[model samples]
Target chain A: MTNLQETKPLMHLLSATFDSLQSATPEQLEHNPFLQLRKQGLDALARTGLPTPRDEEWKYLNLAPYIRHPYQLPAGKESLSHLPQILPITTIPVVFFNGLFQPHLLSPVHGVTVTSLAQLLDRGSHDGTALGEQEHSIGQLLSPEDDPFVALNAALLHQGALLHITQNPSQPIYLASITQSDQPLFVNLRFAIRLSTGTAATIILDLRTLSKTAPTFHNIVSEIWLETESALTLIFLQNDTAQNYGVLTTRIAQTARSRSRLYTITAGNGMVRNTTSVQLNEPEAETVLYGLSVLRDTEVADHHTAVEHLAPNCQSSELYKSIVADQATNIFNGKIFVHPEAQQTNAYQSNHNILLSDDAQVYTKPQLEIFADDVRCTHGATVGQLPQEAVFYLRTRGLPETVADVLLLHAFAAEVYEQLPLEPLRAWIDQQLSHRLFDIVDLAADRKLVDLQFATS
Target chain B: MHNAKQPLLTIENLHVAVDDKQILKGVDLTIYPGEIHAIMGPNGSGKSTLAAVLAGREDYTILQGRVFFDGKDLLEMSPEERAAAGLFLAFQYPVEIPGVSMLTFLRTALNEIRKSNGEEPIDTRTFLQRVREAAQLLELGNDFLQRAVNVGFSGGEKKRNEILQMAVLRPKLAILDETDSGLDIDALKIVANAVNSLFGTIQSYLIITHYQRLLNYIEPDYVHVMYDGKIVRSGDKTLALELEAKGYDWLRSETLSSIELPSTTT
Candidate 1:
């Protein structure tokens, strides 16, 4: 094939993508001034184009499976009344369908307000400041090489939610975003949460795919900006179905003496990708990321996170544990970067995985890039099955094989349970996990390390 | 084939080693019903090796030996299998399994032993009742049942817990390997008391220790002095007192020359 033939097909796809970004019109953005910055952001997204297998980030997790199932946007007003009750955990619900928000599906808190990204853009940029993703970097799919999914998310800029936490105390605000999508579609949402000094609250982003077989593509970007002396606790539970393909890009920027703690418990069946990056932009800042996942069958769960200490006196601890069964696969990439100026920093990360089947695979990489002389950094990764000695001990005690297996599994997950502060929510998640999981009681006898499995209330 | 008529245990020349280091050269011993045999030895005398060899720790290999109990071979069994075969070894260092409650471990071990004995399974009510009785006799608080096995326990508490396990399992042959090492005077007495209360004419015991302090509470019918890889002397409980008074030097003084005399000539 000549160069003309190869370039010809790419030319048509490029033209189509360029036309899509033309959705950036004054009328579409409405009465917004951030449109100027938004246009520049979209132009950058268009320039990056769609990533292919050549891109390392998307190497292990290909977007081709999602791209093959092209989807049409939702038409007319959908029946989201039934969806309100679906988010049974809290009163404040932030609802989205195919990446589009349905203001009708939410019951707003008295002091809280709910609006779409289009409305916010129409209102213009924050105080007319020109902060247009200055570094202009889209992380890679598997590598941080700038994934095409991120560009696709940026292309559909108006379909996200503008979740403003603001500076408040009263009662802790509960922000929930539920996605109820139809058909195989690509839904992109950008969450902007700005917490002022001394502001505190809880936020939850719950992804719900309304169908099972027809695939769904959900590429979301969350920007969490923290102020000095402020604290934010975000719990993300991605419980979408097996056929859904989704990736979440969470970018956190914390201030001096500010602390941000994030707990992500990913369950359910799917090809799920999660990217969480925490930037220690100021001194005396603390960031913690705790995650637990249980993937079975042929499902795949990939987590890529980086905790960057750009300032001195910052600290971070990241622990991620996964239990894979059958042919399920999990990949964990946790990196800790300490800049030369960031002295007296303490950063630690550990990724542990338990494989139930011999064929089940786990790829864990823990990287530490330290340039500072006075910083303390340690990172370790381990992937294997339950300890045979621990297993034999439980089995000898007369626990059935299935019961022993369950107990061993529960023990593997107990490390993350230590970080969850909410009892009810933790209990609910633990209960649901035990229920949906395989019958582990029959694994064998003499497996003694399982009392945690019976900790279910 | 093991009915009520069978002897509790049978042993042949049991040679065991840990990490290829032979600890027991050729140990020959046996115990029938209604007997207590105390094997007293100095440090590095391999008394504990016999206990561990019988417990079926895979870390030690029996190069040449046959251990039969209740008409079945004990050497050809897993650690838990030996326990179910009515053979128990109170470890010198009881393993601490975090998150596993003492009550759960004991009940499971006891029921497995019972099941092997052909008795009906004990229900939860009976299990709780038995645990309460055993815990009280062992001086263990009700809270101990809720805590993880051997975790956060004092030296005395750990010994008492081991005896508490022996009381619960009611094994045919209960081997105590330095079970008195970490116990204080009071804890040692409590553990000994639990041992005395749990023992009966139908069961037997083989207690291994360095000092004569544990002998003050659990009186033994026979005391054997273990030197090098063999039992050099055998007597009644009075042998333990003579050793405490004369010291292990008395046996070492005589045995060292006889073995050393041959080595000098060689």
Candidate 2:
């Protein structure tokens, strides 16, 4: 165990804000169901302090660069009219600015309930109905004591969305979380999503910054609950700027015969870390985890995932690919845990990466811990450069060397991009990847030669 | 069709080495315009090395020699530049590119050649029409255009693909490097037919092969036997059939005795 005393100054810098939040007025803190949870989270943080590189989980990533400056909370919301909309607006959009939900940008839909935590808290007491259900679902699966960032998010939690789907809707829902600030600030956000039994829905969560040069720190925590025989698909797009830092922790709990899929796309930010944990608590549950990370220009991206099988006859599949270039670094840690009682568990994990530059670095660990005798588990990881023969073959076809390289890289990333369920989103992601990876502006014009159509169920 | 006027390709005592081990030791050959020349040799006789050096593969080092294509220095150009300058090598073992479609690859190559010749790129409609016509002439289906370049293709299919590319690119000097090695008899005839369909007075061919069967279909105008990294015999097409009848060991012993007789006489 590493001692936290060596980073006393850094710990003090974070604790000062916690102390001020503790001194809020009684009216501001009274009747808040999260108040006790916040206290517990702060106490847990004080016990563990900040994690150092000596810790096994933080061995490859150093947090010293992020914690060097003292970051204060944003006081109020800024203007939102000038921000550019990156995705299609056909679906219902729930906007969050600086961790606070903005009601004006929301589109109301039937059989769906969208509200903020602050609104629910302001309405005071209610019958044991939707409000009670929101309280029961939020913060139920994630334990703040296990992670310091989750604890910090719980302690300084501002506002987030509470989404509930009672019936299957005709269209998907889009959650847009935007952070904008004139000065350096720290923002904490929390979200809870509950799907009723036999319901199906697709949710797209877009996390981005309004400006490319804003120095912001975003700590986000989300808890998702799926009832029996329910199905859900969650797509998370983490696209920030070079001047921002973010950490996102998501916990998903699935019931018997439920199905879920989580797709995470990380392409921006100076330093970003994502931790996604899934619990198969009932029999015959299925989950698929897919992620793609494109890092360039000295940026760093890390993804840590764990899927635990606690019951019998459950299956899980995980696939993640990373493209690192220009001195950038990418880290991936994926684990599949099968308990003694969880027999007949079929789990597979694969992590493949392409390092484009000589200075690019990648660290990948795919682990399977199976205590059950009858279970089948497999995991593999590969890191390599572009195939030399393939490059020479394209050059023989008269494509310039640079053009050949760009085409090969795009093909490498298309393996993961093809897994997107929606056609429009897939095309959008394909265009964005081409621009960011190779500076190709009109990739759509070349679509006739490279595009492949797959049926979506 | 042979015009005994000026040589189209001239290799002047070409000496080549791969990994510092000499492969082609002082070899010379000449081909006239509109003439199909065949070079027959045993394994490891540097037949492939000659093709690779002409294609500018960069793995082989030229110790001392010069190759002139038409009137320009051929060794000074890059592989693509050589292609643009009307030189092509049909690989014995064609490479497999997993995600690049055949249509995309051929279009890019044709446009690149046109650009180098100071011409505009071919429009999509005309390009597709030409590609379909060429593919049909080689007995390939439309799906072959959408498939990745030679990926999952059978040996015969890959050979036909090489010929299809030859028809599309229309190079002046096409060097077929043992392209009939893994092909069956039917595929051999189809490939030969494709080659003969494109043959004209403006083009020439250098066919490198180990068997006389390929020559039965294409019928080279001249045949040369290569031994010990150098040409030891030169004649017309009958030389291939005679060598096929007696095998290469007889020719090897004859060359050895001729050299020894010269040394003893001196």
Candidate 3:
């Protein structure tokens, strides 16, 4: 882009934000104490200012668009009692509208506290973890000093969830967000999930927009803390409308004996960037990461992930797959780090992409940082089309070129979708895959594929 | 009690070359609907080239030839279209597709053929039944169907799977390209039995091999000897034995000496 576009101020874009949302936040924050603190925190953020491209993480994904646009965090509104009937599969469900929390949409479950970030901080019990002792870590991470959007979200996150699972919670909890923003504006959300010792559960956090006419911006920060003997699986589904712009920052710290797996699938939108980091803090800790992004028609989706093993006997693996068709561009940066003392560490990382059209573009970089002499850490990245032999093998069986292409594409995507163990999650993802393909291939033909002999014999 | 049907496949004046290098020169062959024709030749002979040319392997570009399957313009269609029209090729070396289960692969290929032929896809129950039967036909354990196609499979198991695929496909014209090269006696017997059963049906096969031993169980109606990209002679099933006893060297010398050679199917 030209320098003029880069320097333009967001005041020009402020006219589009959902700015009329101050009155509804108080009651929502009262139900969830975190809302009260968040409002105070966001007020402090407003005094500060936004960050420029000079920030290292925001280098490649310049926040010119975000910086140019002005937005106020939507305050927590009255209880959103009537949640949408069209619900997706989730373990622990949380609702946020226009960047504020909707508590009535939350399910009341045991062994877990379901309150606003305010109440959870004021009255919720903790085991002295970072989130328990330093609830402001998110605030610290998002302040204008570190991140402008973080500060904005801290000030604006009307009612956020303070989800704390005690020792070895047996069931998976889902956090689903359906953003019904009324206009083209900026929205930020913050979440902190802390798991105590011996706790094991799966979590699905989904972010989606209910409206499409307005141009919207969603900047999110989520932190996951895991203690010893804890197992956590996080699935992040960002199904943004094409008129939306989003940036998500996810950070995780896995302590001794803690196992963590993070997966993200992104589709639709003008530009979307996801930055995730998994730090293995102690020995015997393992991490698994698998993410897939499908972009269609003049869209751009980028995913950046870093998995670091700092202690000995730590193991981690990351694999990211991107499928871009038409005029879509994808950027993937995967890095695996092994500290010097982290000998016997096993880390593997790879990023693979498939471009369906000549107009599509992809930039992928997989890196390994190893200071430990005895560690085994490797990384690789590739962007290409389906194998010719694979295509021919299918064609020789009587499938048309289009059918063969779709089948191979599905096989490539199955690597990511199949990693999701939940049946409902898998079914939901499969439905999305069908629609994603419909954007490229004629939907009628794709719909007609059901007549296909699933088994040729 | 069997009524002879007209020949199901005919290859005439088949001249093929791969990358401008001539491989098959003036080769001819014909097979009846129930007949199994075995072509035995020395290394570098046109045995494989003929099979590839017929299956439309890109390597062997057909320079001069015509193949008639069910009296249609077979050469005009693609390899896949041919298969859908009742043609099956048991590859000499089956390709491996990791992350793809044999069950899914077979079902997809089978379904593609069925759909192209305007038939409904098999229901789960019927599909499973057919898989079980095909598995038994080749003595393959049901576990084999779950493994990736030919990946980590024993040498013998790979060949058996080729036959199993044929049994599942049930094509009218099955082409076995060196299907028995790497099989042990037991595997060879299982494969032979599979091929034997496939006979007496509407299906016929063009079996290519370097050895005459496979013909022991799955006897061929006619055996032709190919050498140097040309079929040098045509004879009954006994011709394979004669050639086995007296190597191709003997046939080469006789072809050069005979002044009044009959105008055979070449």
Highest DockQ: which candidate? 3
Q: Where in model 2 is the C-alpha error above 4 Å?
A: A1-32, A122-136, A439-457, B1-7, B259-266
Query: How far off is residue A190 in model 2, in Å?
Result: 1.1
The lDDT of each candidate is 0.69, 0.78, 0.72
Show where candidate 3 strays beyond 4 Å: A1-81, A85-91, A115-131, A139-159, A167-171, A438-457, B1-4, B58-60, B249-266
lDDT of 2 by residue, B108-219 (tens): 7787778778787888789889899889888999999988889999988998998888888888889999989898888888888888888982299999999999999999
Best by lDDT: 2
Quote the positional error of residue A21 for candidate 2 in Å: 7.0
Superposed on all Cα atoms, the candidates' RMSDs to the truth, in angstroms, are 6.6, 4.6, 5.5
Cα displacement (angstroms), candidate 3, residue B130, comes to 1.9
Standalone chain B TM-score for every prediction: 0.90, 0.95, 0.94
Candidate 3's docking class is acceptable
| A179-295: candidate 3 lDDT, tens digit per residue | 655556566666777788888878877666676666567777777788888989888777667767787777788889899988787876677878788889899899999888888
Question: In candidate 3, how many Å is residue A380 off?
Answer: 3.3
True contacts kept of each: 0.09, 0.29, 0.37
lDDT of 1: 0.69
Q: What is the TM-score of chain A alone in each candidate?
A: 0.83, 0.88, 0.82
| Deviation in Å, model 1, residue A94 alpha carbon | 1.8
Candidate with top TM-score is 2
